[model samples]
Target: MTPGLLVQSQGRVLPVGLSVLSTRGKRELELPDRGLVVGAVRPGSPAARAALRPGTREEAFRGGVIVLGGDVITAADRQLVDAFEDLQSVLIDRKEGDPVTLTVVRGGQTRTVQLTLDASAFRVQGR
Candidate 1:
């Protein structure tokens, strides 16, 4: 299947409503690539409803060192996520309001969060 930013839900292609920046882009923003920094989150979107903030960084740390980013997405309804594309791929097939579990690193601590998907028009940029 082709990888893209849009997902099919309820017979319509919709945006997942998350603004994710790559780890490399994070470096340019002066934020350590602790994880993929959520550059911007659509207001009232699934991610926003899930309490995911724009500056939130999703990563895993051990012994005070970053081990990985964009590689730890695990939804309750899906398998392990190896990349951002994998995560998006899963989202595409799921309906809005589907529940997902995310393991993220924030404030030097690892936390598990639950999220629901939201549908929106297409957006090309994270910010």
Candidate 2:
């Protein structure tokens, strides 16, 4: 069946329902129902050196600890990131080498992080 048709029939025809598959036959899905997207890390960049990459989920903690899910971005200036593309747009407005304070929400908690942009880094791919 077509993916669109399958999606429409999902949960209706079966208990688990049908799921759309990607070109490789893997099920495609979105990261956050609403949150940020982290694109890439620049070589020799502070973020990279700090072990921050893409697909990192940012969440706040009771102790104010910021956790980086490699590169999954979740929020900016307290603004909820619904998609990665949208978050990228906002990041683009700033310089690559600039350091910005990011508020991350993860695991039902919130934490702030100091993210330093790597001016030399560009997005190779995103989740």
Candidate 3:
């Protein structure tokens, strides 16, 4: 079994990269962008300590009616970013402290600018 492709327990082959996760008993707080929206920046953290917030959303209600509330991310270095995964994919290839320009839409206005990357909230852990 040294070169075995799997280890079976109770007749079930254990999958690679398998780990137990608790979706139960977890308080799921819904944020604007599938909980990926940056609501509040921690003081003295890489973001707040630096200066970044959830980019504002552009594209007005087109009337009194409205739709999604999350900030609309327009672009990353001239590349269009239309979804949350797009932003995540870009960040994955980057490292902390890397400088980047993000085009954000807020209140129907679009602005392009740069920001330094920081460790995501998920990566930072309490001692």
Candidate 4:
């Protein structure tokens, strides 16, 4: 059966509306070695507006099914991003409406996607 949910619903309120897996998370599962993996993209959000997609592949991790094979975010604004925290760290300092550059690997080919931060994006301090 295809898995579905409300939130990782853990982290959000940032600029983008998508769930991602850190490279280390995949490493634990012995999956592909790379940057943060795109897990899910919220509809109508900036991520969706930018055409970010989730993968068709699925794997069991920590008693839950994790979607894989979408896009791997290798960098952001020329800065290395190997984990969720890395991406978060980059965006947290930027204001909404600012343009951010993301480097993503889709289907073994790398590309850059640029999108302006949405007003709905915010951060929970002390997280």
Candidate 4 lDDT by residue in tens digits, 1-127: 0111112334532222223445677556444454666776667656677777666676654434556667767778888866666777888888878888888878777899887778644533231
Q: How close is each model in CA RMSD to the real structure?
A: 11.0, 13.3, 15.0, 6.9
- Top candidate when judged by TM-score against the true structure: 4
lDDT comparing candidate 2 with the true structure: 0.41
Could you give the candidate ranking by TM-score, starting with the highest? 4, 1, 3, 2
Instruction: Give lDDT tens digits, candidate 3, residues 7-123.
Output: 345755431110121233111211212122333345655445435454233222212111223333456666655444455566677887787676655444566657676666226
Task: Indicate whether candidate 2 or candidate 3 has the larger TM-score.
Answer: 3
Query: What's the CA error at residue 127 for candidate 3, in Å?
Result: 21
lDDT of 1 by residue, 1-127 (tens): 1112234456664332223435664455333333333434567666667776454342422211122222222233444443455466656767666777776545444567788765551234441
Error of 1 at 55 (Å): 1.9
Model 2 earns a TM-score of 0.44
Model 4 clashing-pair count: 1
Backbone clash pairs for candidate 4 read 13-122
lDDT of 4: 0.60
| TM-score against native, each model | 0.48, 0.44, 0.45, 0.66
Model 4 stretches with alpha carbons more than 4 Å out: 1-32, 61-65, 123-127
Candidate 3 regions exceeding 4 Å error are: 1-70, 121-127
Write one digit per residue (lDDT tens) for candidate 2, span 1-56.
00011111333421111122223321122223334434345566655654544534
The lDDT values for all models are 0.45, 0.41, 0.40, 0.60
